[model samples]
Target: MPRRVTVLEVGLLVVLVGLAGCAGMGTSVESTATSTTDPATTAGATTADTPVSTPGSGYETRTVTLRDENGTRLATVDVWVADTFTKRYVGLSDTSALEPGRGMLFVFDGEDGRSFVMRNMDFPLDMVFVAADGTITTIHHAPVESDGDLTEYTGRAKYVLEVPMGYTNRTGVDVGDRLRVDGA
Candidate 1:
């Protein structure tokens, strides 16, 4: 005799499996978010004190320097590099808060028009889009979705940096500025 499975049982099993998969998705993102590094000391320098490797996450931390049009330093930020598809897709959505002077930098293969949304994000952000030549093309102060609707911020960029809300304004980082990533 063989055991038979009912339709309801099969549906329940499928639901459980889906939930299990989703549960594991935030493991890396959460680990990376919990870093206790002091952003003040980590800015503009890539040192041993500023960890580069995030445990359980493929993200690499790098110091990014923002410069004005005349090459004067505007601001410095420590950013987690999101170069791969999976890393970029997850982004900082799983994190609750982005520390001051800390951000996530998304790198693409080449300059192209791209779009980003605050999907499942717990905080607002300022999205800075940079061209391949390091010129900033756009800056958007994106707000967290109050409703279920997500707004897309589109720009032409090879790199997109997401920082705390009003960061661009606070740091005087504006369109046409330049972004220099350490060791990039």
Candidate 2:
């Protein structure tokens, strides 16, 4: 029988793979491998923040594909999935560079209170909030700034996708478009 991999192990492996994939072009990517916080804290962390390797494995890294209106595959990116508390909190905060085809995806438990704040963001990003049925709900083009009144985008979504700035406008990924993932 094949040995089974645990969720923590797979999470670590994906993070390692992401770090390894960032060699040469820019600086290295660091893992935000922190312990899980209490439920109260997690629920209160509105500002803050998986894969079978697909269906079976617990949080595997996959190639996320963004398609146009007529189902034309526009871009395929190797994204780090943030399904954990630590991953959610440390999302793209201190990363040196997010290459042309790389970004982070945030998956939450429910489909409400999905707000994002640019606390430690170093690069401009286009935030796309997705509903439970994979429909795009809202999109925000966020910049790298942390003001006292940091803007918070709240929507009804179970998934939040953060890509490089202008990606949405440039690729024509409108509000009703959908996102598909391969190699989960």
Candidate 3:
């Protein structure tokens, strides 16, 4: 009886081995190890030489022409206009350098007493507030990351022009300078 039981057990083992034939655990382990070491397999990994979007991340910039007080064409800039929430919040943040000719134009829906501050900005800029009738109400010179006790230029201006520091002086842009937004 013991010899017969032994023969039955051996037969069962052979049947199980035949049914589960040749599946490799090593293949799965090797694939996982290879993916772990491969840089391209890493999620959200990019090369250091990856090209970032020009004119910034959230901005939709277009070529714009601006003139100075003497009607001199100062620059042809890719002017970015703010429309969405992210664009409005992150206006010019991390911009350590600015092109001499380019600037941003902020447009509001209606005339309201609005104030602006330079928060998270890396460069000095001039804020020109304009009213509905294209009248510049006030000019605010804000330093880099200036969120101090800066006074708000109180006016009901619907437009705001953010230009580089000393740009107003160079272009002779003064208070009451009429600003015309093309296709506004």
Best candidate according to TM-score: 1
lDDT (Cα, tens digit) per residue for candidate 2, span 8-45: 86698578657756753222222221111112122111
Off by over 4 Å in 1: 1-56
Candidate with more favorable, higher TM-score: 1 or 2: 1
Over 4 Å off, model 2: 1-60
Compute the lDDT for candidate 2. Answer: 0.58
Task: Give the number of the best model, judged by lDDT.
Answer: 1
TM-score against native, each model: 0.70, 0.64, 0.58
Which stretches of candidate 3 lie above 4 Å from their native place? 1-55, 62-77, 146-154
User: Candidate 3 lDDT, tens digit per residue, 12-107?
Assistant: 645644654554211100000000001112221223564322235556664444454555544333456754433544455544444334566666
Q: Tell me how far the alpha carbon of residue 128 in candidate 2 is from the true structure, in angstroms, after superposition.
A: 0.6
Clash total of candidate 2: 5
